[model samples]
Target: MTSSPTRQRGSKELWLDAAYEMLVSDGIDAVKVMALAKKLNQSRTGFYWFFADLNALHIAMIQRWENQNTQNLVDRCKADATNICTGLFNLMDCWLDPSLFDARLDLAIRNWARVDADLEARLSAADRVRIEAVAGMFRHHGFCDEQAQVRGLTVIYTQIGYISMQVAETRQDRLARVPHYVELFSGINPSPHEVARFLARHV
Candidate 1:
């Protein structure tokens, strides 16, 4: 018989996934090594095979967030687009698709940052990188540096408000609103062809 997920040996990925889930679902205090072992239905000894200690696992979790949430959004911001609306739609895809960005992880990290200066600094650095990518997108599409920066800040800050307010909405609900959002953020309505193209990917 196949081993159940709980019965499987502790791999690095498994340990990190459990740690990440704990971090997101119940905050960093709940991400203890013993607790992660319990969640995985494995012994503490098995966790040691993958992570030297709780702190190592915590670092791995933060790295995962940096890769999965922050880096992905920055990449999407720089993705190919024929127009500003199309470009903003790429950014919207990151927001609407959890696979592109883990909103819960982002929120949890922000909450944890409230108590940790090191983490807050890391988060601030990531914010700068992501906001600049958005600004760069605007600059490429014809906005001046100052205008691009303002629009970029507005785009990211609005989404931060949404994520901080608990991840915006369901995919279908949010998808319906993307065109209006893209228009408002870019100050130009997307053509029917552009809107159709963007919506087709999500729908």
Candidate 2:
């Protein structure tokens, strides 16, 4: 998202985008004022206008990751769904769509958190909040407390594992199995109608 050749006035967001790209593409160490400015084709001083220091920029990136990756899943769980299958499918949308949930950024954060105790703490808290939200979805659909909790853990961990493993699979294959996955995770087989609608969205 960074522009070329010159500084764009009011490029705070451009700097953020450049930093985010660097963090995921390289690592946290790559997110320097000089590096970001070079990425944005702006002077190094431009970064200071938007952030006090690299720490401030780091905080901004973490907040974006939390808001986009964690909050989106929670909101999806709370979205309107006519049945358990449909509800679970709503959460699954994140796995299929990068914009809905950024797997790269999530993995990048997990890697970053390993070395940073404070960030690791935040990451842990975010995981709990996410699990609780998914559990709440099951509860809303009449699952027993234990069932809701276990299923929520299963659902969340399954995704985490997939991202961690960096498992490679084609979109077509994943789409074909969506219904089965929904049934397995939701404990309720989705109707053809529901499956078709969900598939239409991804396709």
Each prediction's Cα lDDT score?
Answer: 0.89, 0.89
Instruction: Write down the lDDT that model 2 would get.
Output: 0.89
Instruction: Give a tens-digit lDDT track for model 1, residues 1-203.
Output: 88764456668898888888888889999888778878888888888877788778778888999999989999998899999999999999997689999888999999999988999999999999989999999999999999999999999899899989875467788888899999999999899999898899988
lDDT for 8 in candidate 1 is 63
Q: What does candidate 2's lDDT look like per residue over 72-95, in tens digits?
A: 999999999988999988998999
User: Lowest-scoring 10 consecutive residues by lDDT in candidate 1?
Assistant: 2-11
- What's the TM for model 1? 0.94
* Model 1 segments more than 4 A misplaced: 1-8
What candidate 2 gets wrong by more than 4 Å, as runs, is: 1-10
Candidates' RMSD to native: 2.5, 3.0
Clashes of each: 0, 0
